[model samples]
Target: MLKFVKNHMESIEGVATYPMISLLIFFVFFALLFWWVFTASKAYIKEVSELPLENDNNQPKEDLL
Candidate 1:
Protein backbone atom coordinates (compact mmCIF):
# COMPACT_ATOMS: atom_id res chain seq x y z
CA MET A 1 0.00 0.00 0.00
CA LEU A 2 2.84 2.39 0.86
CA LYS A 3 4.58 1.70 -2.41
CA PHE A 4 1.36 2.26 -4.39
CA VAL A 5 0.82 5.66 -2.75
CA LYS A 6 4.45 6.65 -3.26
CA ASN A 7 4.25 5.72 -6.98
CA HIS A 8 1.16 7.85 -7.51
CA MET A 9 2.60 10.81 -5.63
CA GLU A 10 5.87 10.67 -7.58
CA SER A 11 3.94 11.02 -10.85
CA ILE A 12 2.49 14.42 -9.86
CA GLU A 13 4.31 17.59 -10.91
CA GLY A 14 5.55 19.92 -8.17
CA VAL A 15 4.85 17.33 -5.48
CA ALA A 16 7.94 18.50 -3.59
CA THR A 17 6.25 21.80 -2.69
CA TYR A 18 3.21 20.07 -1.15
CA PRO A 19 4.92 19.10 2.13
CA MET A 20 6.42 22.59 2.58
CA ILE A 21 3.09 24.29 1.94
CA SER A 22 1.32 21.93 4.35
CA LEU A 23 3.92 22.61 7.06
CA LEU A 24 3.62 26.41 6.57
CA ILE A 25 -0.17 26.28 6.88
CA PHE A 26 0.03 24.13 10.02
CA PHE A 27 2.52 26.50 11.67
CA VAL A 28 0.54 29.65 10.80
CA PHE A 29 -2.68 28.19 12.19
CA PHE A 30 -1.15 27.21 15.55
CA ALA A 31 0.69 30.55 15.84
CA LEU A 32 -2.53 32.51 15.31
CA LEU A 33 -4.35 30.29 17.80
CA PHE A 34 -1.62 30.83 20.40
CA TRP A 35 -1.73 34.60 19.84
CA TRP A 36 -5.51 34.74 20.25
CA VAL A 37 -5.42 32.70 23.45
CA PHE A 38 -2.85 35.06 24.97
CA THR A 39 -4.50 38.30 23.75
CA ALA A 40 -8.09 37.41 24.67
CA SER A 41 -9.65 39.35 27.58
CA LYS A 42 -9.61 37.67 30.98
CA ALA A 43 -13.23 38.61 31.71
CA TYR A 44 -14.41 37.14 28.45
CA ILE A 45 -12.49 33.95 29.15
CA LYS A 46 -13.99 33.67 32.64
CA GLU A 47 -17.50 34.16 31.32
CA VAL A 48 -17.00 31.51 28.66
CA SER A 49 -15.44 29.11 31.16
CA GLU A 50 -18.37 29.44 33.55
CA LEU A 51 -21.07 29.20 30.91
CA PRO A 52 -21.92 25.56 31.60
CA LEU A 53 -22.15 26.17 35.37
CA GLU A 54 -24.48 29.15 35.05
CA ASN A 55 -28.16 28.51 35.63
CA ASP A 56 -30.73 28.99 32.86
CA ASN A 57 -33.26 30.15 35.53
CA ASN A 58 -31.21 33.32 36.04
CA GLN A 59 -32.06 34.48 32.52
CA PRO A 60 -34.90 36.97 32.16
CA LYS A 61 -38.05 35.36 30.79
CA GLU A 62 -39.34 36.60 27.47
CA ASP A 63 -43.07 37.17 26.87
CA LEU A 64 -44.57 34.83 24.33
CA LEU A 65 -47.62 37.02 23.75
Candidate 2:
Protein backbone atom coordinates (compact mmCIF):
# COMPACT_ATOMS: atom_id res chain seq x y z
CA MET A 1 0.00 0.00 0.00
CA LEU A 2 2.79 2.40 0.89
CA LYS A 3 4.62 1.62 -2.32
CA PHE A 4 1.52 2.23 -4.41
CA VAL A 5 0.85 5.50 -2.62
CA LYS A 6 4.44 6.67 -3.09
CA ASN A 7 4.35 5.89 -6.82
CA HIS A 8 1.01 7.67 -7.23
CA MET A 9 2.24 10.69 -5.28
CA GLU A 10 5.22 11.08 -7.59
CA SER A 11 3.01 11.13 -10.68
CA ILE A 12 0.38 13.60 -9.47
CA GLU A 13 0.26 16.78 -11.61
CA GLY A 14 -0.37 20.34 -10.44
CA VAL A 15 -1.83 21.01 -6.93
CA ALA A 16 -4.23 18.08 -6.49
CA THR A 17 -3.19 17.36 -2.92
CA TYR A 18 -4.75 20.55 -1.56
CA PRO A 19 -8.14 19.73 -3.13
CA MET A 20 -8.02 16.19 -1.70
CA ILE A 21 -7.19 17.54 1.74
CA SER A 22 -9.97 20.12 1.52
CA LEU A 23 -12.45 17.42 0.52
CA LEU A 24 -11.37 15.30 3.49
CA ILE A 25 -11.84 18.24 5.87
CA PHE A 26 -15.26 19.05 4.47
CA PHE A 27 -16.32 15.40 4.75
CA VAL A 28 -15.27 15.29 8.39
CA PHE A 29 -17.16 18.50 9.16
CA PHE A 30 -20.32 17.25 7.46
CA ALA A 31 -20.14 13.95 9.36
CA LEU A 32 -19.84 15.71 12.70
CA LEU A 33 -22.67 18.11 11.84
CA PHE A 34 -25.03 15.29 10.89
CA TRP A 35 -24.16 13.37 14.03
CA TRP A 36 -24.94 16.40 16.19
CA VAL A 37 -28.25 16.95 14.36
CA PHE A 38 -29.23 13.31 14.87
CA THR A 39 -28.48 13.43 18.60
CA ALA A 40 -30.24 16.75 19.06
CA SER A 41 -33.34 15.50 17.20
CA LYS A 42 -33.46 12.37 19.41
CA ALA A 43 -33.20 14.44 22.57
CA TYR A 44 -35.87 16.82 21.33
CA ILE A 45 -38.21 13.92 20.61
CA LYS A 46 -37.65 12.44 24.03
CA GLU A 47 -38.22 15.77 25.75
CA VAL A 48 -41.39 16.45 23.77
CA SER A 49 -42.77 12.97 24.39
CA GLU A 50 -42.25 13.32 28.15
CA LEU A 51 -43.61 16.85 28.34
CA PRO A 52 -47.39 16.19 28.13
CA LEU A 53 -47.28 13.38 30.65
CA GLU A 54 -45.17 15.38 33.05
CA ASN A 55 -47.45 18.43 32.76
CA ASP A 56 -50.73 16.51 32.71
CA ASN A 57 -51.81 17.13 36.27
CA ASN A 58 -50.09 20.42 37.02
CA GLN A 59 -50.81 22.53 33.95
CA PRO A 60 -53.72 24.99 34.23
CA LYS A 61 -55.96 25.83 31.27
CA GLU A 62 -56.70 29.42 30.40
CA ASP A 63 -59.62 30.89 28.42
CA LEU A 64 -58.50 32.38 25.11
CA LEU A 65 -61.37 34.87 25.09
Candidate 3:
Protein backbone atom coordinates (compact mmCIF):
# COMPACT_ATOMS: atom_id res chain seq x y z
CA MET A 1 0.00 0.00 0.00
CA LEU A 2 2.75 2.49 0.94
CA LYS A 3 4.82 1.55 -2.11
CA PHE A 4 1.81 2.07 -4.41
CA VAL A 5 1.17 5.58 -3.06
CA LYS A 6 4.87 6.51 -3.17
CA ASN A 7 5.16 5.29 -6.76
CA HIS A 8 2.11 7.35 -7.72
CA MET A 9 3.45 10.55 -6.06
CA GLU A 10 6.88 10.08 -7.66
CA SER A 11 5.28 10.30 -11.12
CA ILE A 12 3.94 13.83 -10.47
CA GLU A 13 6.18 16.86 -11.21
CA GLY A 14 6.51 19.58 -8.52
CA VAL A 15 4.85 17.42 -5.86
CA ALA A 16 7.76 17.99 -3.47
CA THR A 17 7.11 21.74 -3.30
CA TYR A 18 3.57 21.16 -2.05
CA PRO A 19 4.67 19.98 1.41
CA MET A 20 7.13 22.89 1.84
CA ILE A 21 4.52 25.45 0.76
CA SER A 22 1.97 23.94 3.17
CA LEU A 23 4.51 24.05 6.03
CA LEU A 24 5.36 27.70 5.27
CA ILE A 25 1.68 28.67 5.23
CA PHE A 26 1.00 26.85 8.51
CA PHE A 27 4.02 28.45 10.21
CA VAL A 28 3.16 32.00 9.04
CA PHE A 29 -0.49 31.70 10.13
CA PHE A 30 0.39 30.52 13.64
CA ALA A 31 3.20 33.09 13.99
CA LEU A 32 0.81 35.93 13.12
CA LEU A 33 -1.79 34.61 15.56
CA PHE A 34 0.83 34.39 18.31
CA TRP A 35 1.93 37.98 17.63
CA TRP A 36 -1.65 39.24 17.78
CA VAL A 37 -2.34 37.46 21.08
CA PHE A 38 0.76 38.86 22.74
CA THR A 39 0.14 42.45 21.48
CA ALA A 40 -3.58 42.56 22.35
CA SER A 41 -4.71 45.11 24.94
CA LYS A 42 -5.35 43.99 28.53
CA ALA A 43 -8.62 45.94 28.77
CA TYR A 44 -9.94 44.41 25.56
CA ILE A 45 -8.92 40.96 26.80
CA LYS A 46 -10.82 41.48 30.05
CA GLU A 47 -13.96 42.61 28.18
CA VAL A 48 -13.88 39.59 25.88
CA SER A 49 -13.22 37.24 28.77
CA GLU A 50 -16.41 38.43 30.52
CA LEU A 51 -18.64 38.00 27.43
CA PRO A 52 -20.03 34.60 28.53
CA LEU A 53 -21.22 35.94 31.90
CA GLU A 54 -22.59 39.24 30.59
CA ASN A 55 -26.38 39.76 30.33
CA ASP A 56 -27.08 42.22 27.51
CA ASN A 57 -30.90 42.24 27.87
CA ASN A 58 -31.44 44.21 31.12
CA GLN A 59 -35.24 44.09 31.07
CA PRO A 60 -37.00 42.45 33.99
CA LYS A 61 -38.23 38.90 33.54
CA GLU A 62 -42.01 38.55 33.12
CA ASP A 63 -43.94 36.20 35.43
CA LEU A 64 -45.52 33.14 33.73
CA LEU A 65 -49.35 33.29 33.59
Candidate 4:
Protein backbone atom coordinates (compact mmCIF):
# COMPACT_ATOMS: atom_id res chain seq x y z
CA MET A 1 0.00 0.00 0.00
CA LEU A 2 2.77 2.43 0.94
CA LYS A 3 4.67 1.65 -2.22
CA PHE A 4 1.54 2.18 -4.30
CA VAL A 5 0.88 5.53 -2.65
CA LYS A 6 4.49 6.63 -3.19
CA ASN A 7 4.33 5.68 -6.84
CA HIS A 8 1.03 7.51 -7.30
CA MET A 9 2.40 10.66 -5.63
CA GLU A 10 5.55 10.58 -7.73
CA SER A 11 3.41 10.43 -10.88
CA ILE A 12 1.40 13.53 -9.91
CA GLU A 13 2.30 16.81 -11.70
CA GLY A 14 2.93 20.09 -9.83
CA VAL A 15 1.55 19.54 -6.31
CA ALA A 16 4.55 20.83 -4.38
CA THR A 17 3.12 23.91 -2.59
CA TYR A 18 -0.27 22.41 -1.72
CA PRO A 19 0.51 21.85 1.97
CA MET A 20 1.71 25.39 2.58
CA ILE A 21 -1.18 26.97 0.65
CA SER A 22 -3.78 24.82 2.45
CA LEU A 23 -2.31 25.72 5.84
CA LEU A 24 -2.40 29.45 5.08
CA ILE A 25 -5.97 29.30 3.78
CA PHE A 26 -7.18 27.40 6.87
CA PHE A 27 -5.30 29.78 9.21
CA VAL A 28 -7.00 32.87 7.74
CA PHE A 29 -10.41 31.18 7.77
CA PHE A 30 -10.17 30.27 11.46
CA ALA A 31 -8.74 33.64 12.38
CA LEU A 32 -11.69 35.44 10.81
CA LEU A 33 -14.11 33.03 12.49
CA PHE A 34 -12.48 33.67 15.88
CA TRP A 35 -12.56 37.45 15.48
CA TRP A 36 -16.22 37.42 14.45
CA VAL A 37 -17.30 35.29 17.41
CA PHE A 38 -15.18 37.28 19.84
CA THR A 39 -16.64 40.62 18.77
CA ALA A 40 -20.21 39.30 18.74
CA SER A 41 -19.86 37.75 22.22
CA LYS A 42 -18.30 40.93 23.59
CA ALA A 43 -21.20 43.00 22.32
CA TYR A 44 -23.73 40.58 23.79
CA ILE A 45 -21.98 40.61 27.16
CA LYS A 46 -21.87 44.41 27.23
CA GLU A 47 -25.54 44.68 26.39
CA VAL A 48 -26.50 42.17 29.07
CA SER A 49 -24.36 43.94 31.69
CA GLU A 50 -25.98 47.32 31.01
CA LEU A 51 -29.47 45.93 31.52
CA PRO A 52 -29.22 45.98 35.32
CA LEU A 53 -28.14 49.60 35.39
CA GLU A 54 -30.98 50.63 33.12
CA ASN A 55 -33.54 48.78 35.24
CA ASP A 56 -32.18 50.28 38.46
CA ASN A 57 -32.26 53.81 37.08
CA ASN A 58 -35.71 53.50 35.59
CA GLN A 59 -37.61 51.44 38.15
CA PRO A 60 -41.37 51.85 37.62
CA LYS A 61 -43.21 53.85 40.24
CA GLU A 62 -46.80 53.13 41.36
CA ASP A 63 -49.29 55.65 39.92
CA LEU A 64 -51.89 57.05 42.31
CA LEU A 65 -55.07 58.41 40.74
- Best prediction by TM-score: 3
Candidate 3, residue 11: Cα displacement in angstroms equals: 0.5
Give the top-scoring candidate (lDDT): 1
Best first by TM-score, ranked: 3, 1, 4, 2
Whole-model lDDT, candidate 4?
A: 0.76
Candidate 2 lDDT, 22-54, residue by residue in tens: 999999999999988777777787777767655
TM-score of 1: 0.76
Q: What is the number of backbone collisions in each predicted candidate, taken in the order shown?
A: 0, 0, 0, 0
On lDDT, the stronger of 1 and 2 is: 1
How big is the positional error of residue 39 in model 4, measured in Å on the Cα after superposition? Answer: 1.9
The TM-score of predicted model 3 comes to: 0.80
Q: Scored by CA lDDT, what does every candidate get?
A: 0.87, 0.76, 0.85, 0.76
TM-score of each: 0.76, 0.41, 0.80, 0.51
**Poorest 10 consecutive residues by lDDT, candidate 4:** 56-65
